[model samples]
Target: MSDPTRFIPVPTPETAHFWEGARAGELRLQRCADCRKAYFPPRAFCPECGSREVRVERASGRARLYSYVINHLPAPGFTAPYAIAVVELEEGPRMMSNILDCPQTPEALVLDMPLEVTFERLSDEISLPQFRPAKGRAA
Candidate 1:
């Protein structure tokens, strides 16, 4: 038998809105009311000064490549040979995501590469955020 397909999530109530926005093709982050810092992963409080007051805002969906790892092994229900990357968003938060829409190769994955968010619909209600080269790249 198999372990079955596992859906990964935070299981928290406060971050629901952020996930919803992702499903709708929009990047969402929290803005600290006290310090005015935007952060990702949808937290309940600010990481800067521990302020509970915050608000959700739309992100520009643009980021620069920070780091990445090319996975040769399959991850659960996923296929082998994928790139898991951390992208530093234009809004000042770094988030973990997958790089897609191109050939996953050593020459293709470069550090500090400019990227833009594009949604891959996993299900009717779930859209996974993936990144590709911003534009004008030879495939």
Candidate 2:
């Protein structure tokens, strides 16, 4: 596989705003003016109803750990024993982001576990959104 982070965004001109927001520690989703459906990985046209009018909407940064795997041996530039997860953002879009700030084990990274987004600065123009366990979990 290629550099995980590089392959992640796959940005286009239309998605620039969304990626920029992530770098700034904000979660942004695209909303269609016509159908009012929120979308992930911002696009020029709304995923629903095929509306051309869309706007960037800030998100609550809350998500659920939809699914994940603990990578014991990872690609170059990735540390071993990290959890890579598909987080279902509260906005209802599922994204591939790493799970950080938590134990990288099966027991600790369960499906449907509440999570929140955090950004790691990769470059001046780019950042990676990772998730961690949501607060108030039992010890």
In order, what lDDT does every prediction score?
0.82, 0.81
TM-score of 1: 0.87
Each prediction's RMSD to truth: 3.1, 3.4
In candidate 2, stretches whose alpha carbon ends up further than 4 angstroms from where it belongs are: 1-10
* Candidate 2's TM-score: 0.87
Q: Global CA lDDT of candidate 1, please?
A: 0.82
lDDT of 2 by residue, 69-97 (tens): 78887666687888777999998889988
Candidate 2: give its CA RMSD in angstroms: 3.4
TM-score of each: 0.87, 0.87
The parts of candidate 1 lying over 4 Å away from their true place are 1-11, 137-139
In model 1, pairs of residues that clash are none
Cα RMSD, model 1: 3.1
What digit string (tens of lDDT, one per residue) describes model 1 on residues 1-139?
2224735554358778877987888888999999999987788999888999999999988898899888998678667788889999998999988888767787888888889998766665566677888877634
